[model samples]
Target: MSGPPTASEDAPIRVLLADDHDLVRTGFRAILGVEPGVEVVGEARDGDEAVQQAQRLEPDVVLMDVQMPGVDGLEATRRILGPSSPTSEVRVVILTTFDREDYLFEALQAGASGFLLKNASADDLVEAVRIAARGDALLSPEVTRRVIARFSTPGPAVQPRRPPELTDREFEVLVLLARGATNAEIAGELYLGETTVKTHVSRVLMKLGLRDRTQAVIYAYENGVVAPNGPSRDGSET
Candidate 1:
């Protein structure tokens, strides 16, 4: 499988703005226009238009509003990132004002790489776009806490799904990931090189059939790979 784009310093990140309100879209365009390595390539007034433009333009990142008139951003994100789509590599960043858990869960399940509040600053927005463009999940600490809580709840007696087969080291990497550790942090904690940690991360994502680290974090909790105040896959507390 191919990895995310490793863009050079000179290559600007292509972005597609998708929101129902024209003024909101315009404001976002204006903010992004001034960033050095970001360019708004297209605009979509609704979810349907977002999907169409994403397919046609294949931008590196899509700023999608969760609540649109029809089709909604959640479904549009799934369609754009689903395996059947031609531009499935496109990364989606869900934009919303509400901090509801349902939207957060749905967005992550739909394969969104980032979740940003509407009231975020211009710098946060630009950084989130660049992060998504580089194929990383941009979950704020607040959202991370929600993720932990949502997936850490007690469930039915029966197991949800069998755990994927992963190497011992990869399993350790996943534990740190579920604890919200970044690549460099994971490397330091594991006493491994950052590049090696990144490889293990990629392998873990591939093996789990997940879209990105955010989904992997969810998977770690839901499948009992890691638990709140519980031992990790290697039978050790994280």
Candidate 2:
């Protein structure tokens, strides 16, 4: 199947707002409404509506709230972005007032491309939409630190096994991705051009059947491809 369609550099990013609260949706619409490259295409007051609107509108980015009355944002996200959906390419960014770890992990597992607290500034919200629209995973520094810490805690020692499907270079790319290294950073570390790094990243995701880099990070840790507190690019424990 074809992947999600990429927006042209000059095309405005189409966005959908999914929040139960009218005020919250209004606030988001206001924030994104004035942004030059972002367009608020639709709104959903509940999870069911979110799914319906997502299918109908096919927005490039969905700003989803986790605590809707029914279905909830996580399940709505799954329905919208899961492999079965024709609109799976549509990116969902979980927006919540809660800073709970469970919500963060659940959102990622549901194929959300980003997660942001409602308290985040207007600039952060705008950037989150832009980042997800560009097909990059978005996690705030605080959230990233939490994710790394979760995996970095010492666990029972087990021998690391590289998946046979990946080339050695692909494995290296996965490690850097799990370390929260951006494509540019990976390029610098590996002495490759940015375009080459992007190709490796795409291959890594394709081979692993991952939706995006966020899943790659979880897969690397869960499968023991890279251990917690593993060697960093600088050869020090991360």
Candidate 3:
């Protein structure tokens, strides 16, 4: 599948709002409407409509609600970002009033690029769109903590095997990424320039066929590349 959409430096970020509530949609539109570099391209009141509009509009970002009549947001997210999607470049940011763990985990598994609580401030909403547009995952601290906690729990023991395609440096980058280190932080730890770290990160993602860092984290844990709550392969604490 294609990577997330990239908005040019001079182009406004195109956005599609998908929520059952008109007021919620309107509120989002108002918050982003005034932003100079963001545009509300369309709105969808249900999951089916969301899927349709996302394919039709090909917006850079989709602000999706978790619960709505008909197909619901989680399914819509899968359809929008699924391998068969026509607009594979679109990034989905799940917006929900509920903070249930099931919804959070399911959203990520559905290929959502970000997840935001409905209680977030207007500024947070605007920043989320920009972040997703720039091909970054924007998980709130609480959500991020939940993800770490979930993966840190011990599962059945299995040997961790590294993908042969990744070099030693790329493997290190993936380990630090799974440990929640940012590119700058990874650079500091590895004594590499930020640009070089970014290159390693991109290479790690591309080699592993991951869509974003969030997926990289999930992949690391699931594949036992970095043991949860334990030292990495290099015998250093993650």
Candidate 4:
């Protein structure tokens, strides 16, 4: 898909581009606008404005650049994603050129669900956003394996461990679910029927004491049940 589903053909996937550079926002708007189902709803020059506009417009997604004046991407991400973050569930994807480890970790900790380079292709941008809108982390799909590997440290291997209560199959579903894979997507990936997948997801959610799939994903990371960079649907599975 070009972007998140719009209300109608004439409608568009509402998007907000948050970056410090004028040219950067302009280029993003142009690329996203040309793609079907996508529209640049608004643009912000800094993180403060980004948060303000997010409060006002409540767009479907925020294509946020990591480095900006006043509030940098990391802090902005934290503020917007804070406990008081808008109830609209607006997803934030970091669109930055820096592969700096510090920013990467911070963004993840701050609750950003996806990360992409400034030079990301128009198609990738569109999909990244579309997937994020579904409440899945876009990190594994877009970031390189090197980035994933970096987090897979071996000093005693202390990544979050799988929850003791979850069965193997339940754990698998949890990963896919947290990664934003739909029930059908999880069924295809795990070789189960959609109905079966739903049962497993429901059971997993209950067992994990989670409110929903989004919390499952955050728990998966915080507990190291799945590495932040694990095999996931980048639209690879239906």
Q: Which candidate should be chosen as best, given lDDT against the real structure?
A: 3
What is candidate 3's TM-score against the reference? 0.95
TM-score, every prediction: 0.92, 0.89, 0.95, 0.71
* lDDT by residue for model 2 (125-161), tens: 9988988888888855566667777777778765566
- Which prediction has more favorable lDDT, 1 or 2? 1
Among residues 3 or more apart in sequence or in different chains, the pairs in candidate 1 whose N, CA or C atoms overlap within 3 Å are none
Clash pairs (backbone) in predicted model 3: none
For candidate 2, the TM-score is 0.89
Q: Per TM-score, what order, best first?
A: 3, 1, 2, 4
Q: Write the per-residue lDDT of candidate 4 for residues 65-144, one digit (tens) a residue.
A: 88888987777778877756672356788886655877876776676767877887888988887777654556453343
Clashing pairs in 4: 160-223, 160-224
What does candidate 1's lDDT look like per residue over 90-145, in tens digits?
A: 98999987556788789888888878889999999998898898888886677778
| Deviating ranges (above 4 Å) for candidate 4 | 1-11, 141-151, 154-168, 175-189, 194-218, 221-238
| Model 3 C-alpha lDDT versus the unseen true structure | 0.86
- Candidate 4 residue 126 Cα shift, in angstroms, is 2.0
C-alpha-based local distance difference test score of model 2:
0.84
Kindly list the per-residue Cα lDDT of model 3 for residues 34-77, writing each as its tens digit.
99999999999999999999988889999999899999999999
Model 1 regions more than 4 Å off: 6-9, 158-164
